[model samples]
Target: MHATEALRRLLEHCPELDRTHDLVRQFASMLDARDAAPLPDWLDHLAVSRLPALDGLAKAIREDQHAVVQGITTPFNSGVNEGRITDLKLQKRIMAGRAGVPLLRHRVILMAGLRRSYP
Candidate 1:
C-alpha cells in the first residue's frame, strides 16, 4: 500500500494516533529550531494525553527536564566521549580473561588512532 493511504487508514481506525503524531512533530520542530520555550507546554500535553507510554516518557523527561533542555539548546555533546567509552567496553569484553592490561592498552591506542585517522 502507498504510505499516505496506509496512514489515512490508520488515523481512521485509531484517532488518538493523530494526536500522538502531532505531538511528535511539535517536538521535532522544537529540536530543529533549537528552542525549548514550548517544552513545558509540550510536557503538560503529554502528561494529560491519556497514553500510558507517552505519559511515562513525559514523567521521565520531567525528572531531567533541565538536562533535556540543555541538550536541545547546546551544540556541545558527549558523543565523542561516549563513542570512546563504547569502544573501550567492547574491547574489554572481546579480550575478557584472555589478555593482560598491556594488550588492552595497545588495542585501545590503536583504536583511537584509527578513529582519528578515519574520522
Candidate 2:
C-alpha cells in the first residue's frame, strides 16, 4: 500500500524513527505478555536514545516503577471500576439539566444491577 511504502521510505531516511518504532513495539509486546522483566533495561535504553518524548515517558514510568511492575505482574486491574466511572460520567452528562440527583442515582443503581445480572 501507499502508506506502507511511505513509512518504509521515512524509516530509511530517519534511522532514529526506525529505532523508536522498534522500541515502541518491544514495549507493546511487554504489555501484552504482562512481563516487567525487560522494563528496567528498556527504560534505560529509552532514556539514552535522545528522543525527548520517549525519555519523558521513561522518566514518568521510573517515578511509578513499583506500581508499573505490580500492574504488569498481576491479574487484578481497575478496568471494571474505570468502566463504571465512565458510564456514570456519561449518564450524568446525558441527564444534565433534565433530571435531579435522585433520578440519576436511581438510574445508575439500576444500570449497575443490570450489568451484574448480565455479566
User: How many residue pairs clash in each candidate at the backbone level?
Assistant: 0, 0
Worst 10 residues of 2 by lDDT: 92-101
**All models, RMSD in angstroms:** 4.5, 5.1
**lDDT for each residue of candidate 1 in 27-117, tens digit (9 for 90 to 100):** 9999899999999999999999999888999999999999999988888889899998998899999988687889988999999999999
- Once fitted onto the true fold, the runs of candidate 1 whose alpha carbons sit more than 4 angstroms away are 79-119
**Residue by residue across 20-102, what tens digits does model 2's lDDT show?**
98998988888899999999999999999999998999999999999999988888999899988987888888887587889
Tell how far residue 2 is off in model 1, in angstroms: 2.1
TM-score against truth, every candidate: 0.65, 0.62
